[model samples]
Target: AQEVHCLAHGLAHCAMFCAISGNAPEHPVISTKSGHLFEQSVVEKYIESTGKCPVTGEPLEAADLLPVKVASTVKPRPLAATSIPGMLSLFQTEWDALMLETHSLKQQLETVRQELGHALYNHDAACRVIARLIKERDDARQALAEAQPSAAVAAAAVAAASAPPTSKGGEPAAKRAKAAAPAVESSAGELTPEIIASFEATSKTLSKGRKKRQPPADQTSAEALAAFGEVASEAVLPAGPVCVDVHASEPLAAAGGADGSVILFDCAKGAVGAKLAGHSKRVNAVRLHPSKPLALTCSQDKSARIWNTDGTQLHVLSHSGDVTGVTLHATGDYCVTSCSDKSWSLFDIDRGSCVLRVPDGSGGYTCAGFHPDGLILGTGVDSVVRIWDVKSQQNVASFEGHTGTVTCLAFSENGYYLATGSADTTVKMWDLRKLKNFHTIEPGAAVGGLAFDNSGLFLAVGSADTSVYDTKTWGTIKSFASGAAVSGVGFGRSAATLAATSADGILKLYGSSS
Candidate 1:
């Protein structure tokens, strides 16, 4: 039987080789004309250029090549190295080659380290840029959201202003629109075009009416204001009453205590009337509705609630943080709340839902109030008092002279002057029309609250003691040493009654029967 062979790199296994390349062909082809075997691709290229086979110089083309299949199954033996000197020489050559290869690998490793350092530096730079871009994107989105109301508000305001001078039911178009249009239903205080439109309409009506508004006839006279003195003192709360408000319609006053209880003291009888309890933490502020039998109170429990005279909770409005302050709208159907979350919210009192929320961006609010006409809102953000137009949600103006946190503020009934009290022991009066601070009073103690009489003739200052100032002369009409911090102050409708609430849970009344 004839034996066939295999292809290997050693000469010991060299049996067949390509005639053209002098190497074993993985796929060999034989030339039919010359009978010479060659690698198919190499010889194919040669034929294309020369048109002849290499070994025999026979005329051949690609079509003349025939594939030859080897049938060898025998394994080739390795070349045997027998001499010791020959083996030593081979080992020495291999070691030298390995050393050269190791040096090459070490150089490649150093190059890789340098490349890695550059890659890390670039990656860090990219991260920083990405972070900055993300912050900018967030800021842009907020600005866009805040700016969305401008165009709509302007259009709505114009439409309202252009309405008929006459009334639909003996009332202005703006007031009618305010009654007809419903508040936007929202749990978050995001401004929408519809909300802006509604707000502007109300602003138009209120702003118009407020321009020519006059003091009511039954206000306290300047003579009666000067004859004020301490008339009564009573402990109306278990803990310090942090705030107080007199009921505009009844002979009662509500004091919110640090123990989360509201004391309903009958100012007429100089005695306790009722105790209302609901809040789980210290009450921050409280107010009785201007004309209704409802009491509104906000607490550190992060909520504000409305209650009827019988102590039934009417509505509970929740907030994102401890509600810092709450103010009733002129209509008594709505309320505004300031929060420690750096946001303030508007709520529909009857619906118990958040109508709008506005983020302050700089600092959390410490207090809140509304203009007497209800066209705008004033809130204390840190040491500054920012006035916002409710219609456009635009920051219309800011009072920025306070050196400490603005603790409380009140708008005069005539609506021209705004008095803000601060923790810096000073009270500043801002003339809204002039947009300037017209007066400043240093109370020698932290000013916690301020109130103006219905006629705007007297200013009630609540601090370490209670002081009454004549608005015209800016002179102290009367002063009472509370012996404790006065957290709140108020005047009766006719200025016949002056009340101050102390941190010691005492309600001090000062007035003259004559």
Candidate 2:
């Protein structure tokens, strides 16, 4: 049985190949620890990087490799050349390939070094800025302490004086709420009552402000949006972007390329502002923080990264499989990412910790986003839209109607509606207030991305084409299918700008150029 008729001669052969490359080693070497043979260069690189034996994973070094004195050396004839000229031609071709590979490695090394240099420079700049901000914060804190008695006494009077809202970013109820919340940093990642209360407070504040918010004065008319077209010739993505997001308040957009890069471009200026290079595979989705100069992106690399306008890496959250979607919490303090690993996680921005990681037992999530109220999260799994209570990490509701896999999702700014796009070539609108799928539309293509502009004027869906529809009437404002199949779509404040990234590497900004 040990020497079966079919393989008896090969099993007992004296010839050995490198454990790493499975090729006859020119100068064979054996690990003293693991007793495994290897091609010297290949194993040495592994040992150098990980400091462990290739097979045994024990401590290893180049010096541990002992050169073998084989009875005979034989070069592999994988090409099976039958004549001298054929062998010579194979050798010549191999030599050329080796030379080219060496040149390519050198180029990659140079590029890595350049990237390292830029990273160090950016780090230094960030450190300086952080130091300045810290000093200013300390000074301000001291001044606040000194003025506390008078300010406390005159608080009601000052409130009557029509001073600008003291809250920063909704104008710092978050800071105040954090102070008041009992389990502000609950180590167990529980949604405590105090935390829920804070969420309610922020949600109420934002919802109230949203009610009075108006479209920017420069917002384009619906007619202009119906005639949407490329306003600039500039795009920064090195290739076709797989996903994109337009800044709600700034003339900026972020696009994720198939090459695993995120380019932050200024739509107003028609130039690239920053390059976010960390993902090792294609980026699947990207989202910009509502008002902060921050970005969130998920990728096939099984990680979601948060970055700032300065190209500084804020956080990197890892997952078990390709991360399909990422979304920011309404308050900008948390981000949620869904992955193909049959799970999704909520990460706290300031603490850099996963508050909760929920198992998606039904199936891996295809897309995800937060409710405008910040108290709820919606995720796509199979054809169902599962809504979770942010504080409790419990599935509170599900919208089920689509016959195909859900592909993308967006929450309306009004806090009452949720839009789920599916591979069934349809987008469904669910009323969160009623917990029901109220409407659905077939866009005639698989929906890839979805967005609702700030003013609740339109919904942009990306598929074979990108279409903008009036939110109230569900009527198409425009449908753009010109350049290439649309991959992602976004809307600037009040639909002042419509940004669409296509499969042909064009990031088109459509709106009144005024």
Candidate 3:
């Protein structure tokens, strides 16, 4: 069989090399081989001149014997002399279309990415809202569960009362009275069988000895006339309605005295009840006891005094320095006083002794108050409120948020909430159950004192700017121009009255529709 001859050039050389090397011939490998062969020849020539190969010992004159000739010049390919403007124009249009497609694809990709980001953000927000809703639902369920039993009992009582009355009511009442009569007689004194028998025998003998006597006609007539008179008087008499004369009186603005004196007013009648004048110096704070008519007053005289509404002194507490604030415990058994000497002390009014002292290590205590339970005391100083357990005399918590000194502290009636008024012109509500602040209300004024009403519906904030806040929503409920800085505010026993003591020695009262 004769083998066909194949020309050795570009394609033929590639096929021959592939068959010989058992691998496809690559352009990069062929170029690299050519460069290596040229470098080797140059290296061999240099080694021959130096009498030794630079890389290896070999004769160099054998490399010069190879024929070296000037290579013929390759002719350039001739350009096709044909005009095809339409084909070029078609290619340019295709390229432009391709570029537009690519740009549109990129924009779509960017749009998709933006939508994905927004979707992710919305998903996160939805998850947060769901979590909050779940928490609220759980809280409501718990409250409902706690109130269920009371609701059922009330329902049962209502149902029983609404039922029709029995017809033999008189007979039943007589029977019940007959059954209770012996029990009452036995309960009055121990009744022995012998004593009972002796009493029965004596009664029988007395009955036999005594003769029944009939009342005279004049006596019967007199008794009948008296009965008629009593019935007539009752018929003409108007039923006395229960009158709760709430003397809600505005405090008198009399001539101001040099010494601090706070006046107590009858909130229902709008009359000045008494003028409190125990403090020898400027009174900085005044608070009313929860149940007692006693008022606690702290003064620059370095003392706090307990005064009755009748202007009589009940007790006097001496501080190391001028007292700045005083608060009575909700139980009215104790009071807490803060002093400019950087110390605070808890006094037991019943025992007439200081039960606990918060040392002046952390600076002067500007304000102090007892928690609702009377088991905890809070002192304000240096822009922080430190809470201490009265029983343990241990500092339990410290609140840090105010930029200025804390001037006042108050606890809600439920004992689950605390409010602090600061010189920073803000009031912060602290949740005792969570041990964290819930919210802050800025009345745009220097908060001098804070108080929560008995119902926990309103907060009386005494400020130089004079603003009050609704406790439930923390909204500004009312405003009044207090002529001077309000040192303290208190709610009376009834939620209808509010009292504010100012630096101008005037105690103002405000009436609430609630």
CA RMSD of all predictions = 23.7, 32.2, 27.7
Best by lDDT: 1
Q: For residues 289-362, could you state the per-residue lDDT of candidate 3 as single tens digits? A: 54555667777889888877677878888888989777765445667788888777777776656766656455
**Which pairs of residues have clashing backbones in candidate 2?**
167-171, 167-172, 168-171, 168-172
| Candidate 2, superposed: residue stretches over 4 Å from native | 1-188, 192-194, 212-216, 233-235, 238-241
Q: How close is candidate 3 to the true structure, as a TM-score?
A: 0.49
Q: Please list the C-alpha lDDT of all candidates, in the order they appear.
A: 0.77, 0.76, 0.56
Stretches > 4 Å off in candidate 1? 1-217
**Per-residue lDDT of model 2, residues 1-514, tens digit only:** 3223223234225677899889978677777667688888889899889999888889999988877655564656666497888889888999999999999999999999999999999999999999999999986764454333223223423332434444455522211101011111222355557656778788768766765577778666677788767676555565664689998888889999888988898888878889998998989999888777788889999999888878998888888899999888777788888999877787887666787777755678888888776777778878877766666555555567788898889987766677888888999887654445678878888887899987777899998888998888999989876466678899876687788887777788777655
Q: What C-alpha lDDT does candidate 2 achieve relative to the native structure?
A: 0.76
Deviation (Å) of 163 in candidate 1: 33
Estimate the overall C-alpha local distance difference test score of candidate 3: 0.56
RMSD from true fold, candidate 3: 27.7
